[model samples]
Target: MHDDMKNTTPDSHKKKRIVIGVSALLVAILAAGGAVAIYQHSASAQLAEAKSTCAQAADRLRVAQNKYSALINGDEYKSAVAVTDKQVEDGRVVTTLAKDSGDETPTMVACNVEDKTALERNTGLIDKNTTWYETHAKTIDADVKNVVKARDAKTLKDTQTALGRKITDAKKLYDASKDKVKDDKTRDALKKQMDAAGKLKDGKDVKKIKDAQAGLEKAMKTVNDSVKAKQDADKKAAEEKARQEAEAQAAAAAAQAQAQQQYVAPQQSYTPTYTVPQQSYTPAYTAPAAPQQSAPQYSAPAAPAQPATPSTPSTGGNTGSGPISGGHGCGSLCTSAPTDTYVR
Candidate 1:
């Protein structure tokens, strides 16, 4: 019986050793599985935390990008273009505030992606944009302020130049209107306005300069109207004087012509008018019965006394007709009247 017990002891020891080895193998497998499960849980938590942080950053970035775009595309930015010259004069420059300062551009992503690599990349882009906008926000606002200042400066300068020209022109008009206006008051008003215009150069205010220009133009209009009125009156008076002088000249000419006609008539009717007709009548009367027209024509100056002289020359005591003698032919119509009456 002792020898049999000794033979089974080795087999028992071997069996116990095999059982301990199997238990150790099972414990190792269970520990490995627990480690893997813990690792997966920790990794998932990390990814969720990263996603939350990235999404919050994305929200901030979106707000920043909206602000940037509004500033760059706003009316202030557009108005800056018109004030280029003024900006240069004032030593102000406007440039791009940010590379992403454009239309409503959102962030790269909202961090809603599941892939780790994608989340990292999009988060980086959003962070970069947000940082850029934050860094230049003040500078962008400053640029807008500068543009406004430049616009005001340009307006002031242009107004000054235009108003200065008007002042100069008004002064010229005032000078010209010195002694030509109908009333001295009109020139006085122009002078007052011109004097006020000179003060415009000293002031920087646009409203003051514009007001001066308006006043000067109004005064100039008054002066011009007054001068025109005076000129018209002078012209009308001159025309009236000229018309009166012309009428007087015409009347004098008519009177002179009438006097000339009266004097000429008196000269024409002196004594020759009656004497000439009688001379012609005497010659014609004796020409019908006797051929003594030549003797009558020659004796026409003494025709009134020729009849008695010819009758006395006849030898007969009663004389019916005159004798035809070579010395005195056709005695009644002889060339000369007898000096004595029929000498014995």
Candidate 2:
């Protein structure tokens, strides 16, 4: 019985130990699960915060870019300085925090911030020049039109002045990166564009303003020459007609004189036949005074009828149709000696 009791006691102790070990393992597993849960929640919350900050930075960059567009396009906009301030303010804190976190992503965030700063700076410079170009382009276009229209020497001169100024300004803007741009190809392209614009704006270039002016002058000369020629022809014709009329008048007078001479004035009745001594002596009466020679009338040689030169009209009377001829006063002048009309 003692042996059996000893064996039973050992079995009971073994069972108790087994129950204690199972309980301790269960407790350890539950503790480990709780720790993992807390860690996951904390990590998710930090990720959310970081994402929100990044989003704010991105939003600021977009807003700054929009403002830049406004400035470049010449719309009323926030001052450039104000836009820069806002961009930096929004991005600085996020960048600082990202750097402090010592995470691998901080380098990327830093680079993004730097890029944004550069964007703002470049756009600000470009915007100023773009605004200038916009205003100057309009002025130049209008001035060129005026120069072409009136062929006004003064307007042409002013256009040259304005274009020169614009070219200089554009050159300065484009030359900024000449030494600094890393890409040689891009730099050369920029320079070429600037040079082209400058050359086109040059007043001395035959293809530019000078050419248009020359064309206008040539057009005017042609018109003037045509008008003068027409006038001269008309005058010659008028003089010839006058001469013919004068000759006709002289001829008519001569004929009338001859006719009068042919008529023998009847001898006064002094010799009248001694027919009827009682009959009163009646003198044959000559036709009352022959009609006085009236001055010959002449039709003005029809204005050297200018051959009608068809021409396209100009919006402004001063500018003639394209450099084609008949550019001047060759229109029909009915009896009026001269009239100003634009012909081309």
Candidate 3:
């Protein structure tokens, strides 16, 4: 029994050791294969992640390019041109941040390259380009802001100057028109509008200033209308006065003409009237003279009928149509010679 026990234990122990050794070798081989697979998967994943990141950066750069394109079309570009000889200077802030010397465009690195080192290098370049785009955008944005601010300030100043001039003109018009306006209220309203415009002169709100200008102009219109109405009324009154004076003068002239005509005396022709005077004479008888010169018995013609004394002219007597011949002063009226019928 002792011999059988020693022989049987040796074989079994040696087989057992061999089997354990084989199992350990198989486990080691399996572990080595799993480690290789894991390493390969990790490497591929890293490359894919890098590609994705690089593509995203490229996309971001495209977006930036679009934004920059739009930005340059804005007013900042115009101001840059105007201030810098019609083009952006190379040394300017935004211009300096443009594409690098080797880069054809401002675009970032692409993800097409598969080498890890190249991908990493491209990633760095993408980051740099991103910074450049951001900086350029920011610089241009600031320039735009400053330009717009300056332009607005200038516009405000010009508007204020114009408004001030308008206010002055309005004031002058008010001074001249205050008393002549038909209504006191219109002139007062104009003054109020001018004052309001003056208050708004320092403001930056263009709309409000323009509104004030409109108000002032409207108020001026009212004042002007009132003044024109008064002027028209005064002109009409003056014309009426002139017409009245002319009519009065004409009437006076007509009255003077009528009085002159009425006061004129009628011319009259005078007719001479003669009145006969009756006289009685006493007869003187003389003794006949015995001795006389022989042939001429000429007695002095009876002392010609003594000339009839002139009597006062009769105002009521009618003038005879025919002329009368009388003893005295009958030469012009008598057609026959005197007859000597009785001698003294």
Candidate 4:
């Protein structure tokens, strides 16, 4: 039993030494693993930080690049091609940096920051220029529109003046023509048309003026035609009156000749006859009557013989030797007197 106990004790001491060595090796490995885990965790954090920084830079560059593209495409900034191209180059450099490994070098970071700053500056300039161009374009457009409106107004004014002159002249012509027209209806119609044309005064309505001008021209034509017709009628009336007067004169002459033929002077002759006159006697025979003896009867003394006068013919048949007058139907030897004979 004593010799067995001594061998067990040596075996137990060897086993204890083995167990201690194994425990020491396990502790060393665990310590080494913990150090490796801590290093990996630190590396992951650094990678995440680098990625976040690169992403931020990429975002900035993208925003700037978008701004530059928009400006270059826009109407206001299309002319700024040279400046926009430089900005595009800067954005390309930033894009390259962002696409590289997350472990960004100091030089790359610096380059990206510089490129981003340059892009921001270029984009700002483009924005400013675009804004200025937009404002300027609006101003120019407004000015052009105003100028066109002014020119149109001037043209309208000139046209109105010319139209006024034409209307005045037309009115003068119409007045003259209307005066010449003798027809009441035609003259009144012409006046009405002229009045309508007169309503086309100077105004803003061009259509009204043109319509009035047409009316005026039509009225002028009507007046002229009326005047011509009236003139022709007057000429015809004058000719007819002259013909009537000539006919009247010819009829008067023919009537005079007929009256002269119907009223021929009657031929008349006058003859005178002599008659002896008896004279009465009484005074010288008174004494002889006293004696009463049968004396010779005293006859009345015969009248002394008178000389006969020649009868003259009367030119007007008014003269007559008889006491009675105005006798007609006398013979050629008898004297004829005229009663009342009117010569036509």
Kindly list the per-residue Cα lDDT of model 3 for residues 16-73, writing each as its tens digit.
8999999999999989999999999999998988887788877877777777667776
Query: Per-residue alpha-carbon lDDT of model 2 for 199-308, expressed as tens digits?
Result: 55545443475544343334334434544566677789999999999999999999999877666444334346554542543322222312321211122323343433
Model 2 scores worst on lDDT over the 10 consecutive residues at: 289-298
Q: lDDT values of the candidates?
A: 0.72, 0.48, 0.69, 0.54
- TM-score: the better of candidates 1 and 4: 1
TM-score of 3: 0.51
What's the TM-score of each model vs. the native?
Answer: 0.58, 0.26, 0.51, 0.32
lDDT of each residue in 1-344, candidate 1, tens digit only: 88977787787989989999998989999899989999989888878877877888888887887887787678976676445543444543444322223324334556878866777777788898798776565566776676677667767787778877877887787778777889889888878887888878557887888888888888888889999999999999999999999999999999999999999998889779888989999987846636434544544545444555553454455454543334444555342343222111
What ranges in model 2 sit over 4 Å off? 1-11, 70-245, 256-344
Clashes of each: 0, 2, 0, 0
Error of 1 at 26 (Å): 9.7
Best candidate according to TM-score:
1
Write candidate 4's Cα lDDT for 25-79 as tens digits. Answer: 9999999999999998986676555555555555565555455445435653322
Q: Pairing residues by index, what is the TM-score of model 2?
A: 0.26
